[model samples]
Target: MTDPVSEFSRPNVAAGPNPFSLSALPDNVAFVALFFQRDHYCTNCRSQVQDLADRIEEFHERDTEVVSIVPESVDHVEEWQSRYDLPYPLLADPDASVGDAYDQPVRFGILGALSDFFGRMPAVVIVDRRGDEPVIAATHRGRSTFDRPDINELIAELDELRSA
Candidate 1:
């Protein structure tokens, strides 16, 4: 079976990198990909991002940057950041291509039959910088989820992926 992470590199990733028209991203950077949905994980993830924000020093020490990517507008980003107290950059990718690039979805099966579904980016990722292919530092989902994961454990896992 093909690995799920490898699935991201496939050619079918369409429709994202929203607010910014620029294609591609910096190669030498570590970023936690915070994908959003209209609700669900998007809203919940704000809390996670805020928690991460509260400990900005730790994230900087680990050399990881928290970037929240969403199809929402700048207004949405502003509202969420202020409401949730998130301290990181809330980037808009209205096209949602960045979410497609990450390839990990929250519910994981809502991509089909769009008429009947509302979906979310149910996971978070710490992607490695400077790699020919970005390495996934840590992903959160399935059982011991984000709000519940050991913060220290998450920090440790992220710490281990330090980019040179």
Candidate 2:
């Protein structure tokens, strides 16, 4: 299996641009926090996105770019962004191309398998982009509906990477 940090080779196509290549991000971007959501229909996912949206400035203060990726159409994602008043960028991966590249869990174990069959397992990936090197500093995966990465923890990771 490939280590999470080494997965920079994976393609990252964003909503606005032709593609938001991770490797191509400017050096000034200290880190990137990518939140992967199942879809706009998931209540838990919506809540999570809202929480991140509420703290968009906190992320920018740390020199990190925050983006949420949803496995839905561009129209749906744009609607969600407007509804939530999200300040960060939202990328549409209708085909889960980025999710597949990051190996997002499509099958949520044995019990939740049926419900999450088409769901992209929730995840938060923090990549340090200081200087010329972009390294994965942390990776969090939610196994259940209630599970999520702590925003405080993400902030701490950014702080730690900045000081390193």
Candidate 3:
């Protein structure tokens, strides 16, 4: 895989027509949008969506917006909403084309040189009006995820951004 920092932070990839810019959302707000790996689709992160819901106040304290981004137009809104108890928007990225624009898999696992191929990388992107680069949540190695986004860690990074 390409360096996460360079892939997401570089001026071109971050601001390109692809890779949904955080500022593109309403109010140029800072948003955390979710993306999953490959065809493993789930609107709500069943294991932790509820946990995210209960602890959403922590994100609210940081003035961060939380939105679940599903790859396909899965009509499981009510099911996921009820299951996760989420009070946030669940946006669809169609065929995950939007995510493809953001991540061009350069290499993956035994299957090296994957940029030629296409697949979704499990991640969360932090988009804001601060600059071109968006804060990368995690670029999991297939079927993996960086569970429990550390609020304090995120707060620190944003603070550094603001100061810089």
Candidate 4:
């Protein structure tokens, strides 16, 4: 049930003096929802991230950690976070290695191949960390740029996990 991406090092946008890494998640963390974004240019993706950002406290109350991964550099993610005022960490996947590992799409069709150079398809991967090793609990792969998980549904799922 282990996904090696959990062992990868990524730059945390909010990491301070004591830098953070995926492997360094808090012990109390019940699970981690990894939101894979195409890039800062996708408004739908931004909105999705914003929705999660707005409900960060609820996530904390449920002992779940949410993170974002973008197929761009740390600097780009930093700028995007500042623009949206996101409180959670945005992990940089400059080469899309993590995205590739999770099978996050690079494009849809021939014309979409253009995205291969600049973007990643939107996706949501929930990894339950309560077990000895992180396990994939659920996942949603966007069919289009605008596709994303429903906020309410995501919350409900997290709540269900909390009560389990």
Which of the numbered candidates is closest to the native, going by highest lDDT?
4
Given candidate 2, what's the lDDT at residue 92?
A: 80
Enumerate clash totals for all models, in the order shown: 9, 0, 0, 0
Model 2, span 107-138: residue lDDT tens: 54555444444545788777776645566677
lDDT of 3: 0.45
Better of 1 and 4 by lDDT: 4
Which ranking of candidates, highest TM-score first?
Answer: 4, 2, 1, 3
Clashes of 3: 0
Q: Native-vs-model 4 lDDT?
A: 0.76
Question: Quick one: RMSD of model 1?
Answer: 6.6
Q: Give the TM-score of candidate 1.
A: 0.61
Off by over 4 Å in 1: 1-43, 106-117, 130-134, 141-150
Instruction: Estimate the TM-score for candidate 4.
Output: 0.86
For each candidate in turn, the TM-score is 0.61, 0.80, 0.55, 0.86
Candidate 3's C-alpha runs over 4 A off are: 1-44, 104-119, 131-152
Per residue, candidate 3 scores C-alpha lDDT tens digits across 1-164 of 21233232111111112333344455445535343323223322455455556666666555566655545444443455445555655544545555566562323565533432233445555544334555554332233333434545555655554455
Model 1 lDDT per residue over 1-164, tens place: 11234322112112223232212444334544443333323445556656766876686666565555555545665566557665555665445555656653545354531411244434466666544555565676433123345457767777565533
Clashing pairs for model 1 are: 15-95, 16-95, 16-96, 16-97, 17-97, 18-93, 18-94, 18-95, 106-122
